[model samples]
Target chain A: MFKRIWGWIQRFSSPKHFYDISGKMIPWFAVSALLLGVYGLYMGLFVAPTDYQQGESYRIIFIHVPAAWMSLFIYMVMAIASAIGLIWQIKLADMVAAASAPIGAWFTFLALVTGSLWGKPMWGAYWVWDARLTSELILLFLYFGYMALQSSIEDQRTADKASGLLAIVGVVNIPIIHYSVEWWNTLHQGATVAKFDKPSMHIDMLIPLLVMAFAAKLFYAAVVLVRARNEVLMRERNRQWVRELVEKI
Target chain B: MLKAFYHLLARDLRLAFRLRHELANPLIFFVLVVSLFPLAVTPNAELLQEMAPGVIWVSALLSVLLSLDRLFKQDYEDGSLDQLMLSPNPLVILVLAKVAAHWLLTGLPLVLIAPLLGLFMYVPAEANGVLMLSLLLGTPVLSLVGAIGVSLTVAVNRGGVLLSLIILPLYIPILIFGANAVDVASDGLSVRGQILFLGAVLAMSISLAPLATAVALRITASR
Candidate 1:
């Protein structure tokens, strides 16, 4: 089992191998993402019952919650990839980490923008220093820092290793950010969907939300794989496989 | 290991003392920036008192950031950083010693001078001790974590702005707790929880930061 996993790591790190495999996977992921996203949106907007207290404004959670979850979720992916890259010196893991940063940043920004739009009607203010909002803002800053570090260094290997270190460090701080912000204020509503017991959300609302979240995950998989393909091409432009592919194209 | 750590630490301290005038820059920056709040915001003592903890803590945070150049730039320029890296001793201990020297020269002075700034901002006398105590606990964490940033960027040309961009986000939690402790203390509330958290963070930074810094230095030096 260990050797198979190790062999998988070896094959995955080969630029041609990753490029070809991810190329095949992208269409599948993209198609699923598009289909699920449309279905989820239709269900959430036209099918889910109106929120009793929050009314229609609460429907924005379909986008906001999934985007917010993706923001944190992608950061975890980046961190884990960074760890793998750093520990085993797998170049593909580093590329994945690098590619995920901007996507993660965009998701965080979407979450914040949609959150504030929701806040305008719900809290009667566009922004608040609430724990969830504040920590999410800090998460955005963490993404920016990661990207900045990646770009400033010229050496690709050094950049990967350096930014990988930074990602691991940022992950360590995420929990600290959450706790500190929570201590500073607590105005945000408590968890609803992630509760271990039956979620407070009605089933009609919950199903679409889960579908949207799954769609977002698939969407990220598609986008990151595309970005990782570009990374592989850039790094391997002079390699034999890339040269042969360029000639064929 | 102990001998190498002590020697490197002593060497950094000695070098810091030789250029004592430069040591005052971050302290001056700290004091100067803190004094600006009254002129810019308001001359109202009550308002100043309200802003005191945040003002002092933020200025101190920036001051520590500005002084981070003192950690590795000089050594890198002189090629002594390579020597330190090549030393037979473990790099983590050497990095820790350099950070201790940095904190002593830069972070420690902020802690020493914080009360004077606190007084200027009308921080009640009761909170002064906590302000100093928080700085004492918080600033070393800054140097430790800041070492990781500096080492990562030390090879980049013009890394000053990038350093702050990358480092400040990491610095947020320390700033939150350190500033809030003073905020809580000024209100005559029990600050035991805040101090404990700061202490916990300090402990974590101490254990982990130097290792990260060492790895970062190796990456940077690989060029």
Candidate 2:
């Protein structure tokens, strides 16, 4: 089974094959993302009970948490994919890495805005140099940096390798950014869900958070597939397959 | 190999010194930036002291960034970099020698002048040790990491602003610890812990940044 799956993965490593396969997956992913997102929102806002501490205002977590998770998660995926492309010379992997950047940056921006909105009511300030928030801000800068590096260079192969090295080096800071709160006496609250022994939050809250996380993963898959297809088309525009495919369309 | 390394380092230093006008630009920028705060804000002594460490650190960071493009730009343009790459010596050693020369020209001067600038912001004498030591340990990391940004963008036209856009975020951790070390010392707290952490970060960056920078140079050179 493992060998068979590996064979399939290798076959799909070609940009042409990946493009065709992702085209078929996009609709299915989109529909499921829409359905799951709606259900997740419904469950989070209405079905979930109000927190004793934050009350109704805590509903922002539904958006904020998922956005934050996606921001970091997408960056990790991009960096890993870029690394694969650099090491394995996989063209499809580079396309995925390049395509995922803008979407990840958008989510990072949303996370910051929503986080600030939440902070105003809870922390009584629009912003503070809290470790988690500051790190997230830095994450936004990292995304911008990656995109800027890729776009500034005209040569495609050069851009990929340069940006790949940067991505790998910048990955060292991610853990430092994430754990800056725990390591220091930061104003940001400590972990609520991810803990050593057990989660600190109640079950009612945990379920919605998990569902939203799953929905976010699905949403990322759907959007990444769509964007990757476009990227492949743009990069492969000079190829014969692209010409034939464009003529067919 | 040793002969080539020393020759490159000595040559870079001599060339940089001959272009003394360019070498002084960042220092003058540092001074000008430090002076701007007093003119813009009210000349309140307490407020100035309060903001001094952050202001001075920020100016130092910007000055270092302003000068970093010079690290590889001249060599890259005059094709000296290609010759260096084709040399018998390893590129990483050449990179290290260049970074050291860059530090001598940029980072060392910043460290020496930091105290004078610190006085402009009303930084007290008591914290001078922290200020000097942090810069001593931290600025090499800045030169090393900034070299990576310089190498990556050196081949591109009009890469200065884009280089800063790529490098400034990466510089935050250094800025945080470097500035915070002084802050802790000024407040009569023990700063040894922070200093040690800064040293560790510096060591890590020194070891890793040159390899990344060498890789980046090869990538840009390939085009």
Candidate 3:
């Protein structure tokens, strides 16, 4: 069984094989993302009751919370891909790590912007150094750093290795950053905005949130796979199969 | 291995002294940046004191960041970095020695000079000690972590800004702990917890950062 599994792994490790497989999987992920997104947004916008306190303004949480979750989640994915790439020198893994950067950065940017919009009505300021907000800002910077480090190096292999080490290092620091921000906020006794979820969170609110979270994850899958396929084509462009496929197109 | 590490450390220190201008730039930047806050922000002593912790920490961070390009660039340029890579001694030890030298030159002086800056900012005399101590514990982590960034970007021409981009986010935890220690001290709170946190960061960075730096160095230097 182990040998058979290892054989499957070896087969999928080839760029051509992985490319063929992912091309087939992308539409499934894309369609699911679209279907789930439409339902989640419709339900979140209309079915969920407005917050008793913040009223209609609270609806932004549907986007803000999921984007925040994706920002962190994408970083973890990048970090793991980086680790696997570094350890095994898997080109696909490196491409995945590279592809995740801009997507992760966009998610971080969306989260920050949506968060500020949410903050304006609640905190009376567009920006506040709340612990969560502060940590998310730092997370955005981490994404920029990863992207910058990758782009600065001219050699792809060296860039992958260097940025992979950084991703691993940055991942280790994330928990530390989160905890310290929490500690600093509490010590300063800054005006703490309560989290989006209250003690009595409704099932109607919960359903859309859970659905949106899945939609976001699915979107990530579709996008990252498409990106990874493009990267694979670029990196394998010199190969016979790639040339033949290109000629056919 | 210990002897080799000592030699590397001593060599870096001697080189730093020989080129005094590079050694002095960060200190001048530190003082200038801290001084700029009062001029740019309010001159009110109370407000300055309130902003002092963050201001000091941020300036210190920028100064360290400004100097990080020097950490590996000079050696990389002179081809000594290749020699270090080829050395029989473990690269981690050598990297750690370089970082220790960095802390000695940049971080130690910053720690010593922080109290006067605190006084200038109207930080109470009681909190000055904590500010200094916090820098003392915190800046080594900066040197160690910054070393990893320098090692990664060392080969890229004019990687100064890119190095900062790669490093500043990683510096957030240290900044939070260091600034909060001073803030807590100014408020007459027991800063034992914050100081301990800074110490913990230093410990963690010391053990881990050099290994990462060494790996990055091998990757960058080989290419």
Candidate 1 lDDT tens digits, B1-223? 9999999999999998899899899999999999999999998999999899989999999999999998999999999999999999999999999999999999999999988998899999999999999999999999999999999999899999999999999998888888889988999998898899989999999999999999999999998
Best by lDDT: 1
Using DockQ as the measure, name the better of candidate 2 and candidate 3: 3
lDDT of 1 by residue, A105-146 (tens): 999999999989988877778885657888899999999999
Where's the lowest-lDDT run of ten residues in candidate 3 chain A? A189-198
Pull out the clashing pairs in model 2.
none
Tens-digit per-residue lDDT, A106-158, candidate 3:
99999999999999999888998888889999999999999999988888889
C-alpha RMSD of each candidate structure in angstroms: 2.7, 3.2, 1.6
Write one digit per residue (lDDT tens) for candidate 3, span B1-223: 9999999999999999999987888999999999999999989999999999999999999988888877888899999999998999999999999999989999999998998899889999999999999999999999999999999988888888898888988898888888988988999999998899989889999999999999899889778
Q: Candidates' TM-scores?
A: 0.97, 0.94, 0.96
* Residue A79, model 1, lDDT: 97
- Please give the DockQ score of every candidate, comma-separated: 0.87, 0.60, 0.88
CA lDDT of every candidate: 0.93, 0.85, 0.91
What DockQ does candidate 2 score? 0.60
